[model samples]
Target: MIAAGEVIERPASVVKELVENALDAGATEISVEIRGGGVEQIRVADNGYGIPHDEVELAFQRFATSKLSDASDLDAIPTLGFRGEALPSIASVARLSVVTRHADDDSGTRLEITEGRIVDRQRQGASPGTAMTVRQLFRNVPARRKFLRTTATETSHIQNMVTRYALAYPEVRFALDTGNSSLLTPGSGSLREAIAAIHGLNVAENMLDISVVDERSGQSTVGGVISQPALSRANRGYMSFFVNRRWVQSRMLGYALEQAYHGFLKERRYPLAVVNITIDYDQVDVNVHPSKTEVRFRSGDRVFSAIQQAVRQTLTAHSPVPEIRRAGATHPAYSPASRQPSRYFWPIEPFQPSPAPNAERTGELIPNEQDAASPTSNGDGGFTHKETLPVLRVLGQVQSTYIAAEGPDGMYLIDQHAAHERVLFEQIKADAATSAPQSQSLLEPLTIELNPRQQELAHAHQHLFSSLGLLIEPFGGDVYILRGVPSILVEVDPVRAFIDMLDEMAQGGDVESWSDRAAYSLACHAAIRAGKVLTHGEMTALTRQLEQCQQPHTCPHGRPTIIHLSGSLLEREFGRR
Candidate 1:
């Protein structure tokens, strides 16, 4: 029992093993149910080949498995379980029950084991599948049971585990019930459809399809959906990887993904991706960990390099060049006067004299406000502007997707929408820190309907919205009235923004603290999008503003706002002589 306690720490661990067993059995569908965070009870049902009545008793013996015949079979371990410790170990520490039937048998056997002993066995009519139940986990080991976390925490871990398998095997249907009313059902279908069902629909919509095939290795095929740069996150938790239908964690694979995005993403920002790699099974080892979550590849470096190169090539080929927005000369009312380059001639005519001293002072002796506001030219003849606040320079838009610009001392590239989000984030944060935000009253109050869950979150965060200059109140049922909004968002549709914010926040998880990330996401959604044109002066002003920021290189969300390349580096690139 003690040995089992060490191996099967908690209910989530039990779920992991059982689910793996189902996968190894070639199950096309799996369902899991847990009560009290899986501590009180756990049930795993799968439509897979079941054990024979004769073999039912042997299935709970330690070190016994049908996956291998001898030691030689260890060289190629393709299944999720081979040591056969899962069932026996779990049975030793908990009340374990198994109901299974073989295809040839008309009836099945039910076996119950407790405290490392088979308590009972009976023959019963059952379906052609397997259903395992575990109860009172770690009951004998009170010390270990005490270490278990809250029900919510344990349930979250189970949810994450289920999500991984759902991503790895889109062809397999999966269902999970957490004893609470919460349920997750990802029906069998296409990878995209599965992803949409598991994650939210917005994530699926933003995913970019990426595929790479290597001709030399017949072992190479990488395909997945990657999030656009604008939709990046602060962590890599959302990224999922599967190799040959098996989910395994490989640091090398993660590094390869980062390398592939070398010049594309900003620092500290990770791409959301779900990639599946197909390689020769013989070249991989899936028996490295007891949990079977880690993998080892023969010549891992070689595989890593190949995957990185393939993804890099694909991204480079698809990268689009930004378009330059030219200023229109027809809009005389809004356009600045164009000036021609000054020409120098021998014995230039004497400078024209002014009728009054004041006129002469303004023309030559005095500096105008416009000239004073402009940055001073440095010794290298480059303008060196500085500012006191963070600024976002308007760079040209590429494929109407990305924005590029030059900041105070570095080159700035922004997802136009992301940049605007940073600006809006600052504004919201400032308002939040002070008293309630100053709301701009709307002539007509806007009403919005929300789901039960959304309404709950909205009511809970009413104070937070009030601080962000939003005036909202319950209008009975799952509807709310928006009587006002932040002055900056006067032009925006208040009802739509409110609903979208609620959805984004819910998807992002609980956010009760002041430093919650949902605030940043909300700001981003309200910010400007890519492809918006700006004048040269506006771009220059943005550069000066960005220079004033403490961390000028990165925005609030940890995405780099600038990339610096020295003048000397540019010369070297061109082989300047």
Candidate 2:
């Protein structure tokens, strides 16, 4: 019973061990069903090589496995279940029953275990597969049963485990039915199809096809659908990776993805990807983790560099910035006079001398009339005699999304929206941290009705809205009334923004801190969209503002807001002098 706790902590652990056993048995299709947090009942059915009638009773014995014959097999362990402790451990803590029929035999076998002891065995009529049922889990161990979390939390963990396997084996059909009637059915074949089925077809449609082969390794292959930079999510949970058809987490793989998207995404934002890597079996250790969710490579550094190079080269070749244009169907050329001053001009405006002290200055509100009357500099060296920073020259907009500019050192490509969002995010975060956000009253209050789930989320995060300068009050039922909004986002629709924020929060899975994410979401929405046309001054000012940022190269979402193409890279691409 003590050993059972180590192998199966909760319902999710039981599912993971059972699925691994099925995979080892060569099952092409697997189904899992759980009721009451897998305490009342848990069933795993798999179409695989079944056990013989005689071996049925022995299957639950500790350290007994058909995978390995001798001690030398330990050095070359390939199957998922070699230790053979999972079955024994699980059987020890629950009422366990296994019914199986081998293809070589006509009849099937049924075996039952009660508290780790084989209680019954009989030949029976059953399908040519294996079906195991675990009921009253931890019933023999009262201490373990008492530690289980709520049914909903346990079910969520089980669902997450099922999803990991579904992603790992795209060729296999997988289905998961939770107790609450929430079903996840991933029906058979092709990684792309599986991804589309699970993550939505719209996401798959926008994916950038990526492939790379290494001739030296003698195992070159293609897999992974890179998302367009514009189709990013709020969290990294969407990124899925597999190695040799097994879903495993590799830090090296994540680093490769980051490098590939160095110049494309914003800081703190992660792209949606399904990267599959194929390598020689001997080069990887799949037995690193008990759950088999993590793996280690013999030469991980080399693999990391190769994957990064392949993705970077592919993106650079296929995706390029489009040319910028002005509004009203006009082809505006880049010129010095058309450029505008930067957004940071207000902080560095001219300072005026204060007037002589009067009776009003003593414990009274004295207005700075002289400072108000003084003319302020625009930071472009155009209006006043104050020294200004050097301005970057605007070249054009790339793919109508990134702005290309030339500075004293080198040329840069800037993602206008990401840069602007970062600027606004920093400003808003600082303001909210120091003082209450400035609120702009709306002429008419906007009412928003939410679903039960969204309503719960909004109620839970009411304090987040307060910090962002929004006065949202519950108006009975699942409706909320918005009386004011952040002054910086005055142009935005309050009701729509509030709903979007709620949806984004919900989609993020589990947000530990609501205020931080809310601030980021607000800043992101208030920033410019991808298709907006910027004036010459706006472009110049944007460049200046980006340069002033602490980490100007990347946005807050982890995407590179700018990419510098050196003369060497340009010459190589164009074959020019």
Candidate 3:
């Protein structure tokens, strides 16, 4: 009973399992009808190979799955919801009714199950397919039903799941009805069409195509559509990833995607993408979760690297700048695509909703090898901007924090702290690669107290400490005296910064990641802070130095240093043509 509860937790889970059964049965068209946020009723009808009357009872039995044969089949199971637990589990908590007929059969069989027991069974005349209606979900388990969110939120989740599946399978037609809202997806077998129907025309046109193949495994292919960095969300909820056409949420893949846009996007900003990954069925394990939303890959590192490289290359090839959209523009009231040079963009078409708008690695989580070897250029580091930053005419400072400058195409507002941080981070990285970093001897030694663990950590990584230009002497049990500090970091709190870096490394991280943490900490502390006044030459010099660095777009912590307000946007805001 508990296991069944886990498989059919909410109305969405029930909908997911029933839909998967339909897909597994080779359904070309599927329709989902939900009422009361799917709590009162959920009807899933699929025009697929219907169930045979003789096997109708067995279908509701726990562990009864038609996809798997033996234990070995578990390694490479392709079908979703193979637990066979979905049916009986769902029937146990809801009022369920199913009517199915095979093409070869003369009639269909109707089975009414209330609270898991067969209340009635009879032969009925019906077309070839299966329609399962579940009502009063969680009726027997009031606790589970009570935990469900309001009708609107639960319905949103249901809509998103259906759209995700629609995007995953463009060839399969899907219809979702939630009374007031009807979503119909054209099963015309075009991914672009499906995306437009589900996400809207703006999103479809804004996305870039991605295709990458691993030479190590000729069978592996990663391809799909990725939204421009500009079209980002505050969360990862909008992103969709799939393995063998089954949508799965994976940290490894999500990290790869985020890391690919390290500098292009600010912290907390997540890009929207519909990424499809295809690999040998034997390489991935989909049985990790009962909901089948998580999966395990044999070579997670390889997959990670493949995805990161593909996204990095695509972004590098084209910019994500949006075209100037006016107030009278279509439904979105804005445009997502731009006329960038040589960009692989899908042409936008007028969007129309049908009956059902079906809308919708790698290794050690490391950066590219070339990025580590390259001494200059943030492009090598997988940052979006590659070429040198454009020169700007200084227009003085704002609120004693932001440096306002005029560029050829747009006006630029630079965050003093972030700009300086990026400048220092690149310089630090370059110095670390060349030789020992420069240090300044303090006239008055600074002392800092630490816990026993921190002291031990400080002592353990003394070599790395010296490499970053910190001359420390152990004072006592939990005290350390800093006699010298990195030259650029002297103005900041050197002792506290050094301790924080040690704490970060002690927390647990790989050597490569530890290096990033060290660099980020040093740059963060050393960089000029906001509210600092600067002369015209100082601001101009800062801007020029920023241009010379590799990733001038953002600081080490992924904060944008500059925001360009286009002249056209200003004109539009001012009501000028």
Candidate 4:
């Protein structure tokens, strides 16, 4: 039982071990069927070279293996299962049965074990393969059984496990049946086909292929498919990485992939990718953990640089400009193939939603009283220009996204979203400097349902949430109630804003403090979007507030808030000098 704890932490762990064993046996076709969230039953059948009749019972013994022989062999271990503990450890906790026939044998053998004791062994008719069945898993250990999550969550973990292995080995046919759901991947040996099978065809079409080899040694190679900037998910769960054909969770690889899309993707959005790095067996150590999901590389820096460069190269070569997809819209507003470089872009109506009725204006620049009184009587409106900023006259808005103004020397174009983000960030910092940031109460509280993992994270980081003016209280199992939010996020949807904040908090491992992360997330969410239409008064107020910010040149995320076109440059272009 103690040994089983190390190899089988949950139902997914059992599936991983069994499938890995099947792959090691050179299985071309594998099938996995489970019931009762894999706790009541799990059957793994593989068309691989099975054991002989005499070795059927020996395969159940601890530390008995055909993969490795001596201590020296550990240096270059090639097979996935080398310790020989998976079969015995699993049998020790469940009722297990196995039927197999070696390629040389005419018939097969059947063996049964209950709680680590062999009970039955006999001859049976079977094909040249192996089929293992486990029932009532962890029945002997009630303590471990109680630690499992809900059935849905457990099933999700198992499905993710299967999909990951299917990506690593595209030539192997794999099928999974959970009695309620099913997934199958053809052994077509095409990564694109595999991606289309798992994710939809539309997503597969947008993925870009990438391959790069280490020029220094030519021993390490990185290859995979990464999604275009237009296709993105809200989280990083879609990324799957493998080392030497073994699925592993690596921080360095993930970081490299993310860095490649640094400016292309917005904050909190991640691209889907399947990255595989093939290297010499001796260069990596796979014996670091019992699960073998992590490895140590001797030349991690070289591998990291290789992955980053490969992804960047692919994106630069095949990436298309991002397009906006609207409801009931048959096609994107712009087509890449028909696009041509020009001084002006195709005009499209900016997105403008009706303002709420009788809603108190929040996140607007300048006070309500000062908004009515204009400092300068411009033809457009009573413009409120500040002294600290460049003396400018509000000319008009361009593309409903940039605020065009006339400066003393030339013209200035300001990105509305970036400028708002800068203003909100400074305001939040100032509020937090004095007290526990400001919060506004909602007319009606909202209840949010979270998954098991999210619930655990919310509970663990309750203090951080409260510090950011989000008053979240436990409503019931896997549910939280929101009574108020940071003042800046009042106009945003309470549910989405809260959930996005929680997701940001979950990925705060690299952040120095939880407060700073929460603050940044709120500011980004509360800032004005790019396509929003602003009235003359609103634009004037926004520009006024931006002028007073401590750091108005760049947003909190380091994006330029404004662009300056010098008068000399414009004159030279027109030959007016």
Candidate 5:
């Protein structure tokens, strides 16, 4: 009794095993409808090779299967539901009923089972297909029934499983209805079309195809689509990996993908991907897990390498992130480092900046050295701006840090320090990538005094520092002499930049990805420290440089760079619209 209990864990598990059986029976189109999160009823209808009326009763017997005829078949199992445990297992727990007709049969057969025993069997007229309905799952075992989650959560599991099958078999049409919601997958045999139908056209359009077609590598083939770095999710929920059309969650594969997107995404952010790895049945062992979601591969490391290299190549071929950036990438209207702190606050505009009356051009608010106190706009924190949108105009500085700006669509509050950090991070990465880390010979050598441990660390990583364009050498004792700095930080304090990089390394990050890690550290410390006023030119320059960055949405540390207040939202708040 508990054996069947292990097979059908929930409504989703029932749906999964049933669907795999339908596919194994050569189904072309399948429809899955679940009610009460599949606890109440699960109806799966498939147009496939159905069982004969005489054998319909026998199929409910445990270990009775047509998949494996001999012992040797165990070494090369290809069918999904070969163990024949699904039907009997499912029958043992729920009120199970099946109606199926073979293509050659004159009539269909319906069988009902309770507690793994065949309770009823009858002949009926039906189309050439199979339809199974499972009701009152875990009814006999009230303990299991009590463990089921809410309908909504269980519905997600079923939906997620159906989506996996839909992706695995693009030629098969799949429809899923959870309560009133429905998902229809196109049976046109195009993975992109399937994705578009399920995830939406925008996500599909943004995906880049990874094809290992013709180019053979080992005993498997790999092909799928991965999202551009610009499209990312906070979790790995969007990533899917398939081995021989079986959707399985493998952490080794997931880690490989994450490693492939090493510097492309912010820490903790994951790229969306649907990777399908096709291999022969002989090379993969599918009997490892009760759920059949975990499998053992003959050459696991090779598979990992293949996935990593394939994804890396695709990203390199077409990436939206910019490659090279230099210092002073901002616009010319502002200079933050050189601006002087003003004594008085400038008067700000009203809560909402009304458009200029009858003016042809939207008069810009260029951040200048004037006592520019602007009106308190509560609307600033609500809007999220895209990089392609119109750039905002700098309206001057506040608290010697934030840059006030106005855009055609809304007003923006820009964090000057964060903005500079993003700018420098990009510049450093670009410079480092080309192995041309721009260095500026300091007029007077900056000596950095470090503790004994830090001094030892500095000496150990002296070659690394030289590679990063930090021309540093021990000046004896617990002191290091810095003669040059990366051009991006040349104007900033060299000693501060060096100390910050060391501090970041101390905090724990990949020193091998020293370019990116060091860049993050360098950008953070060397950025315009808050409380430092910006000149009009400085502010303008920063804004312009920011616009040129690939990912201007957030700083290197994942903090937002700009906050916007849409004009319409402002009007709505003010009762104008």
Candidate 6:
């Protein structure tokens, strides 16, 4: 009972250990059945090489393992089960029975052990594999049994474990039946297909493939699939990492994944990914933990760099503009991030100041000369994409918000506010790099009051403020004077924009630097608000500038800037195909 505490926590632990043993035995097909959340009955059947009839009795002995012959083999443990503690530990806590026939044996052996004592041993006709049934788990340890959760929760845990293993070994057919519902994977040897089976087809379609190999070392390689920025989840539960085909819990892997999506995911949102890292057995130590889910890498830095780079490169290269779905369309079952945030917050004419007398009638919130100028970039900005969309031809504006246009392959709808924000954010960062942004002194400086925390943030981020053309000075206790603001925000309220910056810096997660946080807020404040009518030339200019942005797909806030409606999709919607 004491040993089982470390290896068998609940029904899920038993399933995990048995599955790992089957995998080590080279099983190509595995099936698992459970009742009462695997506490009443649990069965795992596999077609792997089984134990010989003569040795079947000795298999339950503690520390008896075929994976390693000597202590030196511990340094380079290759198989998933090496200590051989699973059988004995589990037998001591539950009623266990095993029927198996080794490949070289003409007959099979059956053993029924209850509470670590054999009750039945007989010869039987059986296939060349192993079938283990654990019944009345933790029956001998009433304390442990009392601590188990409800049956439904335990079933979810077991199902999750099985799905993860199926992802790691796509070539192995896996099935789990809880006597209520079941899951099956085809073992098609395709990662994408496996993902579709587990997460649904819609999510699988949006996943991007990533593969990176260190040819110089010829020992480490990383490969997997990552969700597009549009297909994220609310938690990191979707991220899975495997080392040498063994599922492991790794904080470094999680951090690397989040870092790769720094500005590409919303607050508290995490990407969905299945990343597998393959390296030499000697390069990683899997015995760090009793469960074997934690690994220590010999070259932790190299592994981190490889994972981060692979995910980053895949995202930058393959991320596409989100598609706009019609009403009543089926939303992806796996994605909560696809639903855009509410847009009603962008105030309309009620919030705009009076237009200048000679301002052009360009459908902008502030019909001023500043809003009419086209956005600019400092470097050659178009990416060398594998499949580039043709230059868009501006059609017209939709609902005074979305810019409807056409391309060679499909139609495009661009969010004017989001597109402009993307453009201005890049420009702000670029200008900050070269020189301070253009600033205009106010006729009379505006004074504002801040709390102690905000005041501290202001003093610490003055350089970032100056870069965005926001010049501030401490006037007195908890008070500051804003001398000038960015040229783009001359017409907007400088005081509100300044306060917004402080709030962002104070509340924003520490992943982004103060400068990025400042630029993000500044761009959002200065960008043209939605619901403004734009002249044809203004619309043309907006889309053209958007195309020059390095990351034209999303705004700084990770909202989609454009939605593409492919020609084939349009045809299907129109009943033409």
lDDT of 5 by residue, 1-577 (tens): 1132267788899999999989998998999999999999999999999998788887887778898897678776787777778888889998999999998899999888887877888999999889999999998999998988998899999999999899889999999998879999989999989999998887787788885643555443778999876678889999999888888989989988988886567788898898988877888887777788888899998788789888978765555322111335331111111121121222332212221221101112243323122332344542122223344567888789788887654467778888888767777676566777656678898888998767766877876676667898888888888898865564567787688787767765444555566778877866777898778867875775565565665676656676656566577667988
Clashing pairs in 4: none
Could you estimate the TM-score for every candidate? 0.57, 0.56, 0.75, 0.61, 0.68, 0.82
Give the winner by lDDT: 4 or 5.
4
Q: Which stretches of candidate 2 lie over 4 Å from their true place?
A: 1-5, 182-186, 216-218, 317-577
Compared with the true structure, what per-residue lDDT tens digits does model 6 show for residues 239-319?
Answer: 999998899999998988898886677768999999999988999998887788999999998898899899888776666
lDDT of 4 by residue, 16-88 (tens): 9899999999999999999989999999999999997888888878878888888777787788888778899
Candidate 4 weakest lDDT stretch, 10 residues: 343-352
- Tell me the whole-model lDDT of each prediction, alpha carbons only: 0.66, 0.68, 0.76, 0.76, 0.74, 0.80
Q: Give the candidate number with the greatest TM-score.
A: 6
In angstroms, the error of model 5 at 535 is: 12
Better of 4 and 5 by TM-score: 5
TM-score of 2: 0.56
Where does model 4 exceed 4 Å of error?
1-5, 216-220, 328-577
Residue 184's lDDT within candidate 2 is: 52
* Tens digits of per-residue lDDT for model 3, 276-344: 899888999887777889999999998888898888787755433233345676532222233121211
Ranking by TM-score: 6, 3, 5, 4, 1, 2
Q: Indicate whether candidate 2 or candidate 4 has the larger TM-score.
A: 4
**Top-lDDT structure, candidate number:** 6
